[model samples]
Target: MLQNTVSTRRNIGGTEFPILAAALPVVANDPVGDTYWHIRLKAATTHLSSRPGQFFQLRCPRSEAGDPFLRRPMSVYAVDTNVGEIAFLYKVTGIGTTGLSTLVPGDTLDVLGPLGVGFDINPEWDHVLVVARGVGLATMGPLARALHHNGVALTAICSYRTPEATIGLEPFELHGSVHTVYDTDGTSDIASVDSLIREEHARRSFSFAYTCGSKRIVSLLQDLSSQLGFGGEVALEQRMACGLGMCHSCVIDLRRGDTVESVRVCTRGPVFSLGDIVAPEETLSWYRSCDESAI
Candidate 1:
């Protein structure tokens, strides 16, 4: 266990809290669907305060393939602040996660943070749409719980390789309705998801469209939000050596008015304002603009 570990206080967006390096007991580690593992940890009360969209850097145990050099970042699937539990959904891919998948109920794992800013829930938002695909389905649970707690209505669009591969439906369904789209059935295509989102929005206008798991889906939401006049947010996936912002490895450009500025995904966001994001097609121009500024 990460017993009696010292926590360092860091000021983030003006709030100072201890960033814990806790060794939490693994309460459960089991597969969800055929694609993902659902791991539950018995957390300290301080650790349970993580919000939806926040992630932790879990130190994976060494396995047959050898040591994973860095901790793996996984988004919070659920957090019960009162119950002292936290959960994560992740797939066993590559060296790190393969080791993660080997964990059992009796083990203790080292973890850091409730790192980075999480999704900002607008309590006034009456209706929200969440789009997720594959393992991204795991990232939606806590967000669903939060929206449900706020009495906000929700619609979740889950895309997967097959119907049986779908994950996280229970938490989302407990909070609101869920729509599954399958690649095996061609319903996971952008065009099909676009149509589905439009039909659902028409039935009940969404105040916000939030997405993770697919960039194409994020683009569709960005376009639709503009056309439909609703707010939008998106979670981005990036490879990180350090889950903290200090590494400069996970910096991404974000638009602030006419200027584009770099921000760390591990700190400023893994969740960004969909409207404020610099489009992928404009990346070259942003680099050029940065060059011109330097010159």
Candidate 2:
């Protein structure tokens, strides 16, 4: 369990008391590649209730001018409320993450969360098919662990562009059966997301399909879920500034029956039902552009 934990309420961004904190870091280090970092936060009482895929708006302590005011959003990688700790798996993309990467073990980071909607898993569903690409595995890992602890079966299909880009698989395999797919590497027999899904379906019936990765993969899973006659959810990677509803930076167009409506990713969802999203091409493009801009 985490030490020195306490809880307090505070107002942020015109919203009264949305965050709680222990305001300290328990773990911080670079993962295998420079592309990502693993951080564990010892939270105050309020951080205990977060669900998988929900995120926090993190505030980095500044040393110079021209730093951004609004906290940057990052998904909850793992939660151990008993220990008063929350884990984060984030890549160093911009000034926020770069500052975050520089922190030592004892540094304090201001956090506002557990924000955004998370994956909704049905208790009745015994088997879950998890389709992940790149860092999406971080968003799905804790849910896989929770479901596994509850006796639900987990089958993970992790896809990467190459062997070097592959991440978060070692821990995921601990919770379930893991199949790694590399597009340009010959380490695994499966090279594509579609091929891996077909392999899983050929073996057994999966009640739920959870995806968090590329928009192309999400689109594919939506079609496959309908064909397989199962419910599914997608965790979108959007460019979010506020991690709250006010900024309007993370908007997504969703289909609500015969009509389409726009929803903010930070508030309405970072996770959405497969049937809810409309054409995500523009949103996906925006994310890529923003992510590139950060780099």
Give the TM-score (vs. native) of candidate 1. Answer: 0.92
Range of the 10 consecutive residues with the lowest summed lDDT in candidate 1: 286-295
- Model 1 misplaced regions, further than 4 Å: 3-13, 284-295
The runs of at least 3 residues in candidate 2 whose Cα sits more than 4 Å from the true structure, single-residue gaps closed, are 1-18, 63-66, 186-191, 281-295
Give the per-residue lDDT of model 2 (tens digit) for 30-116: 565758888887776667677787788788655333365767777888878677777888877667777777777777777877777
Worst 10 residues of 2 by lDDT: 286-295
Decoy 2 TM-score against native:
0.84
Total backbone clashes of candidate 2, pairs 3 or more residues apart or in separate chains:
0
